[model samples]
Target: MIKLFLPLCILFLMSGCKKSELEAVNSSPTVSADKAVEVAAYEVEAPTPPKEISQKLLPDVNQSAQPPITPKKIDTIAKKIIKNGNMKIQVGDIKKAQTQVGDILKKNNAYIQSEQFQNTDVDDNLDLVIRVPHKNFDALVNSFSDGVGSVLSKNISSDDVTEEYTDVSIKLANKKIYLEKYRDMLRSASTTKDMIEIQETIRELEDEIDLAEGRLRLIDDRVNYSTLNLSLYKEKVRSSATSKIGFGSRFADSVTQGWNSFMSFLLGIISLWPFLLIIPILIFLWRKWKSGRTKP
Candidate 1:
């Protein structure tokens, strides 16, 4: 029993020495964690800035800083106004007055748009529709009043088309811009479908542009030219050159009536020929009867 116990005590002493050696080898040197973190901090990269914060620090250099330019306002003087007028005058001689008015119009660079003449027992009336430049509108009306004859009626009208004109102008400009863009799109087109679509768009824009331009042209014409309606009249019965029947005309009228009456009487006698035959037969019978009575 003593021998067995001696060997077990030796093994136990060896195991304790091995355990102490392992503990000494596994243990690390004592150092503060704060000191270790500070030492290695410089080697690490800095934290990235937030997306919002970074944008504020550096702005885009290519962008413009100035404000956009604004368009100017249109003036009233530049507006379009259409003028119209109407006049009625009574003159001594319509033909002479018409000639005078025509001369006046020619002098003012005006022209007759339309004219009408009416014939009546009382008088011959003349109606004239004239188109003159706006500058000459009032002048032409005044000339008719002063030179043509007595002014019986006069009227003037003014129409403001500024808003409509401006609207058409703006629409025309927009269509022009759209047409340019569509043309560019057509140039860059790849597929047939894309080309056809762009071409159609361009055609539509061109049509719109044309329509707007036409409207603008009409407005310009209306504003540039003024319309005038003039009426002229002269009393035929009151005029010195009135129509009258003379002695010679009366003699000819009487002869024509007498001839017409004789022709009418001849036609009536020809239509009674059958009845006249029967009347002659009855007269013969009556004469024979009277002779027979005398014999009895």
Candidate 2:
């Protein structure tokens, strides 16, 4: 009976050892799971930068570091100027002065646009309208003032037409654009009313364009060529009777005049012959009456 009790106690000790080993294994698994959960939570809370976000920011930084681009500037146009002048000069001889003026014009590359001449008892005048290149305008005026004759009056004027020219040019371009559009519309018009309206608009635009072009042409002409109104004047010298005559000539003229006076007196006596005969008849009658009275 002692031996049996000893074997039963040994078996009980073995079973208790197995139970402790099983509990240790179960606790290890629970600790491993808790470690895994903590690791996952740590990963979730930690911060990480994405390469795509860095790339996007890098482009923005590079762009900010680069220089800014500026817009290009447009070129400026030339100025438009119109010049005009009026001058009056006193000359010695009109014909000779006219010839001299012609020579000067040829030298200056100018021409007489119009010319007029007047001769009077008091003076002679030669009026000329001269057109000269803009560059040569002042030179021509100086030449005429210094060489041609004495200047009586001079007037010079300059007009700045740059603004007007620019405005007209822009308006003309716009009108041409509208005109083209109208023509295209007219071509594609499906109805008579639309065609007629487009045609009318086109006509109006064409007229405006023509007028603007003509004005520009006129302005260009005035700017390129300066106009000058030139007047040449010469005073006449009158002849005097009291001056510069030889004694012999004066004596001859006086003798001729005296002879004319004597002839006129003789003709007057011939015209009175009828009156002389009547006087004689009256004298005879008077004497007869006196004798008759004395006898009575």
Candidate 3:
């Protein structure tokens, strides 16, 4: 009975020791888990870098660094231009130069619109306005400049008449259409009153068509020809004697002119009969008074 009791006591002591060791192991694991949780919270709460530094670390790709480029397009349309010119030149012989100018115009398929020859004591001048083919405008101007004489003045100008020409053309075309419509109306007329009205309308349309055609013709002429206004003059020649005169010649001419003027004055006074008689009576009275004074 004593041995059995002693064994039971030893068994009880071993069981108590085993239980204490198990509790200690469980407590150690709990402490370790709390430490791990604290470390995780500290890591999550740590401060981050400033926004500017973060932006510098990660660059954007949308912003371009190269310059923008531009390209040019070529034009392909031709412009319509009306040319005009004005010129003045000096020539040797007015008549000969006028003839030569006419010949040049004919050769260039041109015609004179107007011409005037003015001869004065000072100079002989020819003024001309010519209409020349547009294709020969430049060539004619160059030829006149080089072959005519010394140029005094030159002016060349251009106007854009394309718009005017197109407008006139469109009007002319519309008028022709109206003319055809009026003719058709005249054909469809059956009553005398209707016929008279249609005929009158046709006449009106015809007149309008004529006017439009006239305007078109004028435009065509202007477009096909270029206008040139020209003036040519002959230089006055100095007489050889005047050109060679010195001081002596000028003095002689002055004396001769003065003498001729005095003679002409005397002749004028003689022509006045009343003045002639009065002069003779005054001369006689003066002579008598002089003799009386001498006697006294």
Cα lDDT tens digits for candidate 3, 119-167: 8867888899999999999988988898888899999998886777677
> What TM-score do all the candidates reach, one by one?
0.54, 0.59, 0.51
Better of 1 and 3 by lDDT: 1
**Model 2 regions lying over 4 Å from their true place:** 1-75, 241-296
Q: Model 3, stretches more than 4 Å misplaced?
A: 1-80, 99-103, 238-296
Q: For residues 218-249, what per-residue lDDT tens digits would candidate 1 score against the true structure?
A: 88898999999989988776554445668888
What are the clashing pairs of model 3? none
Clashes of each: 0, 0, 0
Q: For model 3, what is the error of residue 269's alpha carbon versus the real structure, in angstroms, after optimal superposition?
A: 24
Query: Residues 1-296, candidate 2, lDDT per residue (tens digit)?
Result: 99999999999999999999999998999999999999999999988669777657686778688698988986464899999999999999888889989998998899999999898988999999999999999999999999888999999999999999999999998999999999888889999999989999999999999999999999999999999999999998777765578899999999999999999999999899999999999999999999999994
lDDT of 1: 0.86
**Predicted candidate 2, C-alpha RMSD:** 17.4
lDDT of each: 0.86, 0.93, 0.84
Top-scoring candidate (TM-score): 2
